[model samples]
Target: MTGKIYIIGLGPGPAGWLTPEASAALEKVTDLIGYFTYVDRIPPRDGLTIHGSDNRVELDRSRHALQLACEGKIVGVVSGGDPGVFAMAAAVLEALEHGPQEWRALDIEVLPGISAMQAAAARLGAPLGGDFCAISLSDNLKPWSLIERRLQAASDGDFVLALYNPASKARPKQIFDAFALLRKLRPAQTPVAFARAVGRPDERIVLTTLGEADPGVADMSTLVMIGATTTHLIERPEGRPFVLTPRSYEANR
Candidate 1:
């Protein structure tokens, strides 16, 4: 009785942004697997066995999920953001492609979730309103040199950037280094947003320019968004100014 596997993105925090499809998938799964905190985010339900694992063990977690599904246990592997975006969706696919051919024939689905960048963009107005790209700042899977080159290329291409995994206790310097690198390529006034724990009770959003941004404010939970040269601010009398990157390229005619 082989079963299916669902890779679900729980969204930035949890229930707030979970898509109805994702919610249903979670409910249907006999087993839920993911990072410890992400697994805990699911509300307790009957008959769902949750498998919580450590950080940086994505491949192991994914393979295990596939195995469980092959053994007839419907499974859902959760990711905090959209599974396709620097998350478990890729890992699951990688495992399927490399693990066992039989695993490929099983029904597999990727349920989308609101990415942290999307949550950050909404909270900070529309910094990603225009042409933009998302990049993972963590070099755990790739080299730092490649990341630097990509940063420079994004700056050169004049695209607003949404950087994920910007900082963590283990690799704190990368975020600061990234900021420093961008400091040289872009103007000092390029707006940088540090959105921490979006959608969570302790969420924080700090907007600052590249010139005066304090990297110290960011931690593992922060998602950083850097505006392009054309990105601008719109004043609001009541609250903080809104950020927008014009969707049109018509040079302010």
Candidate 2:
């Protein structure tokens, strides 16, 4: 019997946001594996076991999850944000393929959840309605040069961009480089939104412009939203802060 391995995204951090399907998957899993902080968010489920680890040990954690699945133990690997976007899905898949031949027969499924970019865009209101792209500034896995090229392409294409893993302890200058590239193609006044600790108790969303969105606004947990060429600032009639991205299709007519 082949064991099933599930990569599940827990969303930002409120249990109420967990989907019924995800919750049901959680209920069926014999073992849960994820970063320590994310594991703490899940409520205790009957007959579920957990494997938690510090954030630094990605390879070790992936191996552990694969091992459990190989042993015919249903495994659920959790990630806080959407598994596909700068999360565990890639790492888990990479490990399974490269680690050993034993992992070839294991059944692996990736389930999606609310990404921080989607959640933050909702708070800003229609900043990504038209054509858009998402990029992660962290160069831990990919080279910084490739990240720069993506930034330039998105900027030149006038695609609203959602940035994840903007900055981290080791690579503090990544956001700065991204900002420079965007500024070259995008106007300095292009609206940008920085969301920190999104959906959590201490959530903070700041509205600013490209020139004003310095590296100070970024950290490991921050997500950045950059508006498109048609995107502009709009003050809510009720005096709230936000921005709007107008669809280019409207201009064609």
Candidate 3:
């Protein structure tokens, strides 16, 4: 009997957002492996072993998870947000393809969960309701030059942008550079949303314009969405305003 490995997405940092499928998979796994922060999200349970590793060792983590599964331990590899979106699913698949041949025989499944961009869009009332694209600002695996090119092209196309890993301790300037590049190409009043710790207790949102938005306000937990020119805000005197991109394309025609 070969134990299978499941790659589960925990949604955007909240228990409520976890999908029923992901929750069910978690219940069956004997071991949960992920980054330290993500592994911490799983509540302590009987008969479960938790393995946490540093942020940079995703391939190593995938290898270990596959190894455990081959040993007949049902293993769960967890990632916050959707594992497929700038997360662990691709890494696991890549590792499996290049790793020891035995891993190919093990059962591997990727369970979906809410991605940060989707959660952020929900809270912002659909800035990505139409054509949009997400780009990660981190250049860990890819080059910074490629990131800059994508940013410039996204700006040029006027596509709604959802930025992931916007700013961290080491890569702070990339966000600033992204903003500067976008500001030059986009209008001053173009709506930009900064959503932090979304779906969690400490969640906060700030809406500003391309010219006036400050990159200092964002950190690693933040998902920055730059709205299309067609996007607009609906003001509410007593609550958070609704921001949306209308579904109509009459303006473009």
Candidate 4:
């Protein structure tokens, strides 16, 4: 008998952020597969088997999960944030599409959870309250030129930008280059937020303007939000300021 496969999103970091649906799915799976960090988050049980691989081998991990499911083991391919957003769901689907015909007939479900961008937006005020777009700064799978074009288009269209994978040890310069480009396109005073390790123990949220924003504060874990021209901040007496992008654009017209 063919078993099932679930693409589960574990949310950003804290266990509380995990959705009820994803939790329930996790309980049913006989095996879990994912990147080492995310797979390590699951507690070991007697009947459940966990497979952890390197961060860059998403396709191989998906194939292994599919093979296990074909052998009648219920499998869970886990991801940190929402699996559909630059995570394992797409990888699993890609595997299914190219794998043997029997693999296609196996049961598969994608369980959604809170994404990093959403978590970051919540930690701040409502920076994504209006029109917005998310762009992954990592050019491992795609060209940097494409990313630049998308960034320019989003800026020109006045959409709030949620930038993922802003910087890493290997690709540190892209974020700075991106900042330079945004500086040319956007106003100096436009709000920019650096939300790092959000929802985790070491969470840090920094709010600044485009001209004053510091790119060095970001890493692989940070989600950088560049505000539209309409985005602004509200000062509070007690805590950090609130960042907001208005939903209506009547004033701009």
Residue lDDT tens for model 2, 88-179: 89888888878888897889988888899888887788887788998988788789899888988887787899999888888788898888
Model 1 Cα shift for residue 112 (angstroms): 0.5
Per-residue accuracy of model 4 over 1-253 as CA lDDT, tens digit each: 5799999999998989999999888898999999999989898888899898998898899999999999999999999999999888999999999999999899999999899999999989999989999999999999999999999999889999999999999999999999999999999999999999899989999999999999999999999999998899889998998898888888754
Q: What is the lDDT of residue 48 in candidate 3?
A: 97
> Which regions of candidate 1 are displaced past 4 Å?
none
Q: Candidate 1's residue-wise lDDT over 1-253, tens digit each? A: 5799999999988466889999889889999999998998887789999899998999999999999999999999999989999999999998889998888888889988899999999999989878898989899989999999999999999999999898888898998899889999989998989999999999999999989999888888899989998888888989989998988777732
CA lDDT scores, all candidates in order: 0.90, 0.84, 0.90, 0.92
Q: In model 1, what lDDT does residue 131 have?
A: 86
Off by over 4 Å in 2: 250-253
- Compared with the true structure, what per-residue lDDT tens digits does model 3 show for residues 1-253? 4899999999998778999999999999999999999999889799999999999799999999999998999999999999999999998998999998988999999998999998988998878876888999998889988998998888777789999999899888989988988888888998999999899988999988888899989998999999888888889897777888877766743
In terms of TM-score, which candidate is stronger, 3 or 4? 4
Q: Which residue pairs collide in model 3, if any?
A: none
